[model samples]
Target: MRGSVEHSWGWGHCAPSPLLLLTLLLFAAPFGLLGEKTRQLLEFDSTNVSDTAAKTPGTPYPPYSLADFSWNNITDSLDPATLSATFQGHPMNDPTRTFANGSLAFRVQAFSRSSRPAQPPRLLHTADTCQLEVALVGASPRGNRSLFGLEVATLGQGPDCPSMQEQHSIDDEYAPAIFQLDQLLWGSLPSGFAQWRPVAYSQKPGGRESALPCLASPLHPALAYPLPQSPIVRAFFGSQNNFCAFNLTFGASTGPGYWDQHYLSW
Candidate 1:
């Protein structure tokens, strides 16, 4: 009877151990292991500027005098009405106008088509990320250039964005989802010269408080940051809230100039 007994030692005949089973499960569910893709949500080109200008009402008098040309006139040629219509129908009509409390307000959204399918539909955690890329070229006439400051408000509440409107009127609270970048210069550059800088920001509260470096092109116009790594991703996506809309404002420091060639991509 013993001579008739036999057993197979093949892989199919042996059941996997508990540890092996866990490894297989992990491999099957790799959602957390997948890397997030960088998404470009907006791009503003020369045509955008012209279109915005055409849609905006022209000022009877110059918005600013030559003495203070480095003030709100930086975007004089841009029409807020045109800009709002061109992008998403958010209010960004007056790039130079300020709120009653003095905070500059520029509310606009990324071009609708630029939205990426991979971006989460909601804001879940504190690690969501976004980026802004700008390239500005000034006219030939050089003068006392003005420094520009930018405040980007990515989330808001209300019928459209009442909270954003309120924030624009007051300087008291820093919007949790706001990203502020200061000291942008515009004016008098060589014909082919352009400054390209890309800044990435997190969507979490107090995200801007982190000491992230501002990467820019080198002082020499001909030199540039290594393309692949300049705008570094400082955080990983850990939340469900994706920045679907944006409010862009040019702050108190912007100057007047003819931006011959300007580009913005997000």
Candidate 2:
């Protein structure tokens, strides 16, 4: 006859051994470190738009006109009809990605008029303001069923539009919530985030201006983190992690002037 081995804690029921419990905890530790879900809102790479890369060298920086570049829209899993973008060139659309009901998302890159640039093109201006516009359908039914939040970012140089600024507004009758500018322009990220000042929903589009601590501009290149200052609302917008979903129009303006070497991403 062979003796039987039984495993039990102080209670009558059998329990896992200390070593096994430690192994289970160790296995689960990684999951805790896993971050929250983050959708790639928009990414722009503009390093290849130098004078040397331009089709005609020395003609003028940014060889191709901003209007000549095309937008590569990535609808990865959203209804085509529901999402739309108003850009200069014909957009390259892909319908293969999974769909998220009532949600529309896409991305575009700035390429040369004839061929895609080796890198993303910077929104440089010699005499006029350069702008990009995007629109999304607001959430229906309101409450949790509605879209969670909205976030935007620019990866390249400092304040893509130092002299110009982007405007955001909603069409619904109900006054939409406002997001105050993040205290820190680029919060702990390698990017220089856009600092969006608070503006009343009733105000005319492009009428509001961003409030900064100092008039001096940080000309240096850094990731832009344009998120609200409120901790709770900031997290809600996913600005802390980098993500946003909102229905609004972005208009860039130089106010009858020209900006040199400015940059923008979408």
Best by TM-score: 2
Q: Candidate 1: how many backbone clashes?
A: 11
* Cα lDDT listed for each candidate: 0.20, 0.21
**Local lDDT at 24 for model 1:** 25
Could you give candidate 2's per-residue lDDT for residues 1-266 as a string of tens digits?
Answer: 00001110111124344333222222211111001111122211222334233221111111111122233332232223322122222212323311112232222111112221121121221111111222222212121111111222222222232222334545322223332222222223322222323221111122223211111122322234332232322322334332222211111111110011111112
Candidate 2 lands at a TM-score of 0.21
TM-score list, all predictions: 0.17, 0.21
Residue 30 error, candidate 1, Å: 35
Candidate 2 Cα errors over 4 Å, as ranges: 1-127, 138-147, 156-266
| Model 1 spans > 4 angstroms off | 1-129, 140-143, 147-266
Question: Candidate 2 at residue 138, lDDT?
Answer: 26
| Superposed Cα deviation of residue 74, candidate 2 (Å) | 10
Deviation (Å) of 229 in candidate 2? 28
RMSD of 2: 23.9
